[model samples]
Target: MKPADSAAVALLGLTVLGLAAPTAAAQVEPDPMVAGQRVRISDGRRCAQDGAARVSSRLFGPVVLRPGEGGMAAQARVAEGAAPGRYPVTIHCASGGASFTETVTVRDARVEGLNAAQAAGGLALLALAAGAAFWLRRTVGGRS
Candidate 1:
């Protein structure tokens, strides 16, 4: 092959490799979960130290990250009553002070429909109040 042709082939190979290989930006992963749901993440990067690993969010709670296998596993529970929306997740790597941030979406549980337990409880409370009111009216009115 000609020198120029060889150069072109090398450039093409580099471009293909660049597209095929996953970059650092692609390594960070985001897991989406509903309110009160648990999400697990498996990360392959090792941090600087044990205490250096951290994840945080305001809507939910702190992420419990543990070293496992060749990487790390993170467990985070979404707040039971957290409002449906996108929340920011911040991950702190123990090594090199590197941080990663991603957004997780929380879908409203109520969006599906009314919860049976909540509806039943509300109805029961309403009936009890009505019965108490009837009793009060009968007694205070001096009626049988």
Candidate 2:
């Protein structure tokens, strides 16, 4: 093959590969978010420069996105009644008419509360405080 023709074929191959490459994906911070908590959505592709991008999820209704560092960002509150499970969140960019979906896991708010270990720690602290108080009373009262 002619050197020039080979160069053209190489360029075409690179072009095809570039076009087929996947774009950066959108992301939700604080994965395994608790119901009713606010979550930040970040668009890694910066596709919302036109200021018409939107994000939506079953757990949280449509949220209008605004330009943010690194890309676009938006905050949405998970419904208080959202069930504990994984839900798909989609970001639609009006500029390129491109949409990306990311899965977000919603956890029950109860999970945010103290667990068994924490409860045990609290109980231990309480008992120690009570014991200290009793000892102080016994020593001071006897001296009196």
Full-model lDDT for every candidate: 0.59, 0.76
Q: Candidate 2 has which clashing residue pairs, if any?
A: none
Candidate 1 ranges with C-alpha deviation above 4 Å: 1-30, 44-52, 110-144
Best by lDDT: 2
In the order shown, the candidates' Cα RMSDs to the true structure are 26.3, 22.6
Q: Please, what are the lDDT tens digits per residue for candidate 1 over residues 1-144?
A: 643445457556756875798633212233335777766644446454365376767755666556766465666666788887877766677654677666766776524445566689678667755665665566567773
Error of 1 at 6 (Å): 21
How many clashes does each candidate structure show, in the order listed? 2, 0
What's each prediction's TM-score?
A: 0.49, 0.57
| TM-score between candidate 1 and the true structure | 0.49
lDDT over C-alpha atoms for residue 41 of model 1: 49
